[model samples]
Target: MATRAELTEIFGAEGVISLPRSEATAAGLSEDDARVLCDVGFPAELPVIFSLDVPGDPSAFSLVPVDTGADITKVLCLGGPSGNSEMRYCLDMEDGYVILLTLGRQPAAEIINSTVDAFVEFLYRYGLRLKHIASADDRQADEYTKQLRQYLAERDPQAFAEEDTWWNMIFDRLLGKEF
Candidate 1:
């Protein structure tokens, strides 16, 4: 997991906000997850990934019950659904894996990344989609994509390969586009 300092360094101080310890605890966040949430907050809009809910919303954080009708505790809700959609991003508290939950979908939860840090890294690298593609700015999108690819290749080669494949599949599903 990346430290707060590391995240701030990569994303800049303006993009990150540290929540109070009490707020994080009240959110039912684990020590590890809380550290990330409290120390390195996410961006306001995360298109094709998720938009963060307001911090300190008691209802926004908790352990999510399994969707199988059988009672089982598995994932922890990190924030509310993005926009009006039922899809929410969560964390597998036990393993610290980032997951996506579609409330009305057959498969309730899908693993997105290996850790919270990795998920944040993904956002940092690819979040330009929110500004460019969301606005249909093809020229800016192309430039951002080129920069993202170059960044990933230089920073983490393995993640560069995996993230390309993962984001393609995830974005397709999120946009409801058949490929």
Candidate 2:
């Protein structure tokens, strides 16, 4: 998993948001999962994909048990791509896998990552490349994006296992420069 220092280098300290261990656990994440989140923190928004919505205080903290009959991490993406629909990115309470759930359609839940660690690594690598891509020419941007995709595939094959997987969809969106 990427360390907080590395994430800070990519996203800046303010851009990374994380809850304390007690809050994360109260929010339904496993101790291992909570450790990664609390230790490294995650990006506020990975544009064209999802945004983080971790509560700032204990009073506002509560784990959402989605329509799938599965509990989800509170540090989740609550809305759709545009922050409007019922789509959400949640870490399954039973398993540490990150799931992309479309409420009311439980069958459509797509596994976003095999594990929270993989998810964090993806976020870190993606954010780092985005920084590099921002200053590059179009050719360099394409090459960097391609390289990032390759890295993700090699790092977490399960995430790219299906054609309709979130990571695959995200690559298409990256081409459109949505992030």
Where is the poorest 10-residue window by lDDT in model 2? Answer: 53-62
lDDT of 1 at 164: 40
Candidate 1 has its poorest 10 consecutive residues by lDDT at: 54-63
Q: Tens digit of lDDT per residue, candidate 2, span 1-179? A: 78888988877888777767877766666778878777877777766554664223111123555455553333344223435255666667676777776655443678888887788788888878878888899889988998889888998999888877788888867777453
lDDT of 1 by residue, 7-61 (tens): 4554466755555678667656678777777776665445435556633322344
* lDDT (CA) per prediction: 0.59, 0.70
Q: Clashing residue pairs, candidate 1?
A: none
Candidate 1 segments exceeding 4 Å error: 1-19, 26-30, 54-59, 67-71, 105-107, 128-140, 146-166, 170-178
lDDT of 2 at 134: 84
